[model samples]
Target: MHPKKVQKLIYFVFCCLFTLPVLAQNRVVTGRVTDAKDNSPLIGVSVVAAGSATGTATDVSGNYRITVPASATSVVFTYIGYTRKQVTITGTTLNVTMDAAGTALNEVLVVGYGTVRKKDATGAVQKVNAADFVQGVTTNPLQQLQGKASGVTIATTSGDPNSSPTVRIRGTVSLSGNSDPLYVIDGVVGADIRSVSPNDIASFDVLKDASASAIYGSRAAGGVILVTTKTGKAGTPQITFDAYTAAESPLHLLDFADRTQYLQAYQQFYGKPMPAGTSTTSDQGANTNWFKLITHTGISHNESMGISGGNEKGHYRGSATITISKEMCAHLS
Candidate 1:
């Protein structure tokens, strides 16, 4: 054998040794997600192979690609507002359409110490989230859970921006101490609801009956409000920005009288003469809309920024938010 030929064959053998392992790990799965009802592409659907730790999420166009272990037998897909779907592995490409789980019986609910399926909970607990929150510009988290939760009453005695709403569970338990439900935000025993941003909340659960509230012991006589925040997962870095702008006019603007209407009403009843130089135009002078004068459009601007990322070792997430609101009422003093 020639030395030059032997060296060429050795180089070829080295290349084949390294390429075999790379080709063995080339098992890939690709798919698209869509809405079951409309056939619309669904983005951000989480896809994970059952027997493997590797996972991936769909893109904006509802396309997903993930690498699975050779021994994997199934894949599971999940989204926040959709039903979970698991399919047996038979081929390389698997497309899925998720149905809207409006009445989510299998949905998970947080209880005293842990979580349970919504249908499995034996206690009287009502859950509220962004989808079911009371529609309004609410500075307090309790406002979102108001009226939706039976036996739960909320009262805002003072219109203070920083003031927390007084929550009473099934009315007052006792005449003393002004019955207020125990506040538990992100597992903090006595956390204040005012400190938590409404947009950052993932779930607001009310434990109304004894079965659910018993976990808190005697302190839960008035019931309990369990608040859970969002969490991070192992995935690519995700950043979110949210801006809220609210324009509010008086709710009962027509219920009150305008400047001209007020003048006429006074002249009709008491027969009082009109004040001199009281101009009469809708936009100017005395004819101004009294409702608009005493109350302007309430405007508030909110901004929030959050970032999350993680790996197999651990996950992390953090966010910050700022809100500025202008009072609509004018000082009469």
Candidate 2:
């Protein structure tokens, strides 16, 4: 070969020898971790290379960077409240979304004055969790529990916005006034359910029969309703907002006489047409609709915003909400 060609071939051979060693070494791995429900990043999640000591934790934004040997087959990602995830090392970057583990079977319920595990409680107590309750435009917390609990009956005496519903447990107790069950909120005995908003409640527990009511003695005669509010989870501070707007009208409107019918009725009763100019309003012309005049679409809204956070030791949550509704009157229009 020519001298220049020989030199060029020698240089190429040297470069290949140097790169071969690097290619056999460990590979760099990167990924991100997020929540499956909200897609929020999970920080400080443990990421470990399978069958190797190589490992790293995610940053505040759930991004992780690590290096693993060529022998590594997969990487494992884990968080406290989420299920573990394993991804094969097929590419340079992997993104994982983890779902919350099933923990409802281990949930704790607040009874009369104490608390007990849900599985251990033998009472007829039926629990309606935050997810099961009706969420929108509910002022009196009892409204959230309507028809959800067995043997519980909810009745509203009127459509007044400020009035709370009468929640009866196990029918009439003594044929007396307001046989509604007693409400206990956060351990406050005989609490008013109206004071708490459905949007703020975390759980609604109803204690029925003697087994469940034995905790409170005579006060439990009418049964009991226990309410628990939301609290922060162990993690970084997070802000959340939820809102709902609803409009409601009567299911059926009343059928009434129009102007012609009113005049006819007057003629039938008094043998005379409707007196001219007796009423200056449209009703005199029979064009006025009595039902429509008094009835309007009832509008209601529920809005809430909160911030919560904590570490392993303790956690707290604070929130504010607004609810608007008007009394539903008879729709004469």
Q: For residue 159, what is the lDDT in candidate 2?
A: 74
**lDDT tens digits, residue span 1-333, model 1:** 999999999999999999998788658889899999999999889999986788999999999999988777889999997888999878889989899987755778788878898878999888887688887677777788878888888888865567888788888788766478898988899787888877677878899888998989988888899998877878998999988888766677566666767888877887667655655556355455566677888788878899988999998888888878877787787
Off by over 4 Å in 1: 1-108, 116-120, 155-158, 253-293
Predicted candidate 2 versus true structure: per-residue lDDT over 9-62, tens digit per residue: 999999999999889788888888999999999999999999888899999999
- Candidate 1: count of backbone clashes, pairs at least 3 residues apart or interchain: 0
Q: Tell me the RMSD of model 1 versus the true structure.
A: 18.7
